[model samples]
Target: MKRNNWLSLLEGKYRVEIISLCVIIVIWGLLADFVVKELYKLPGPISVFYAFYKVREVIPLDIAVSLLHFSMGLAAGAVVGITIGGLMGWFRVIDRAIDPLIEIVRAIPPIAWIPFAIMWLKLTHYSAGFIVFLGAVFPILVNTYAGFRGVDKVYIDAAKVLGCDKGKDLIKYVAIPHSIPYTAAGTRIAIGIGWMCVVAAEMLGASNAGLGYRLWSRFYLLHMMDRLVAYMIIIGLIALIMDRIFRYFVEGKILKWKKGTVAV
Candidate 1:
């Protein structure tokens, strides 16, 4: 009876998800099989599955390289964004001095920096990471600034009464905690953008070995539509997995206080 109850619970929770996935797969399969008769255009699930086997030897390395680029960029972006954003938030003079420069730089698309990245850093992981950084840094900076700016004056006064007199101390204790949600939101956006930038960076000659590189150079150039589609699907799945993991940690652990609230 207990086992039956558990099974029912699982089914109830996942029924919609399961049904949606099945429906999507069925429609995709039908479209590939009937409407898109040409394999080059749409290769269906079976072809994509087989393509994974065809490129199984290199998928791990590609994934690792892509992740390396992602980590490098994200780490650097987060640090710089938070530091600068904190300073800007804590001081009006700093904000005025830096705001115009930041706005001008961020106006340029990350892809536009590829030439400079390759020229300055060469075809290396750092160059790829640089592109990812451009894609990620702005959102985090903006969101963190907004978060810090939104901190209540009452909280600052209370902190001051509690002996948090120094600017750094007040920011560390009062502002940082209040801004966590905003920072988290920015980081989430950065993750998606950074992931995409890493792929684009790799494809556009930032690195010689990555999912994007292989997908564009090996699969697409050779007209291996199945393999190309397979890589695309893999990229999407990895992004989805990353987002879910981040959400789990942030919502389940870091922001546990928000549970049972509308924000959760």
Candidate 2:
């Protein structure tokens, strides 16, 4: 009975959200059929669908550019941020010295760094990657720092008594597991920030590619409204997919020890 109740809650909550989405879709379809049909010929879902279906042919180059930058920037940010964060967290003096500068840099909006990125990297892929790094790095660093700091002292004490203070074994047996939640949270946040910065990062300089560049290009062209909307939807869906993947990986593995929510 207890197991059944938990299963029911998960299904119920998931179904409710799906139903809400369906309701919104139905409302949109109706509005498109009646009001929009009579009005200024705004392309509805059909147009959006068609645009998406045909997008590869319409803007292959631009799509490739956007994906390239997004992937590259995210990868770079994750590597650099985790390395720095782990180091700082593992060491007290280094954390104190670097933490202040990290905070200051993090406080500056990523978009504001566009000028510097462009100037430093000169309208290259690295510029976009740098922008993405700026957006994603802070969340990763902060989460790692928190997690490392939050590790129970008792575990460290035990590790010490067990003759575990020498080499790789110490970090593997002690520090890594203790900070899994922090690392997971930081990775989740970094993914979100990287996605959010995609458009702005791509917008940093002149080129004939990327979602942001394409949006600007299309606005100037004043054609293919549905294509623009399709791009927006695609970006949103990608983010959603990434978030779902993250949750599954984190909760199912890294955070399995956490108590599951109790259903009423």
Candidate 3:
């Protein structure tokens, strides 16, 4: 009975994802082994797995370095973005005064700032973190601003009627709660962008010890295509894990109230 129950639970919860992953692996293996005759162009699953095992010892250090860069940049960007965005949304005058400058800055691509970051901080962890921060901040700022602005006037009025007319009270009780979904969405986007930026920054010599550094070293210097593919797969797996962790904590637990509104 216990085994049956566990099997049913897996079928209900993870069936689609499991099937999709299997299909993707099968297709990838078939194409790499048969269709793509050029082994260097696309290594088969077996080659990639062998490479993974070969580099298993160094994986932890690379993962740690990359995670440190990602976490530092993401935390800083979230705090600054959310604060500025919240204030701008709450105050029309502030928004008007700051919007033009923000728009001008946002027009520049995050990667474009790499030169400036290198000049300012040199090719160090801080430079990499700065690049990741640039990648993460804008999406969070825009989404947070939009979320706060979209808060209904009716809710504000209700708060006022309940003697919560103070700005802080209204924002704390009404605006913040209403904007949680938007913030969560922004955070999700920020994480993806930040991860990409970390890799890019590392590739550009922002760090000497990271997954990106190893990936570039394997591809360019060592000419190890199989190990390069292994690094790429590891990066993807790390991102997937981070995304799932965020969703489980933020969406699944904090936003439990939203469950009733959607059909599972």
**Residue 242's lDDT in candidate 2:** 82
Where's the lowest-lDDT run of ten residues in candidate 3?
255-264
RMSD of each: 2.8, 6.2, 3.4
Among all windows of 10 consecutive residues in model 1, the one with the lowest summed lDDT is 255-264
Give one digit per residue, the lDDT tens place, for model 3 in 1-264: 457864675577788887787789899999998899666888888888899999999999999999988988999999988988888998999999999999998888888888888889986788889988988988889888988999999999999999996899999999998887787788889999999999988887777778988898656477788889999989999999988888778867778877522111
Q: Model 2, 1-264: lDDT tens per residue?
A: 457864576577488887787788778768887787832245577767787887766567776787787778778877887778877888899898998899889889998988888889887888887888888888887777776777688988898899887746666787777677777777787888887787877654533468877765763256677777788776787788888887887787667786331100
Per residue, candidate 1 scores C-alpha lDDT tens digits across 124-162 of: 899999999999998889989988999999999999999
lDDT per model vs. reference:
0.89, 0.75, 0.86
TM-score of each: 0.93, 0.81, 0.89
Best by lDDT: 1
Native-vs-model 3 lDDT?
Answer: 0.86
In model 3, where do residues sit more than 4 Å from their true spots? 1-23, 260-264
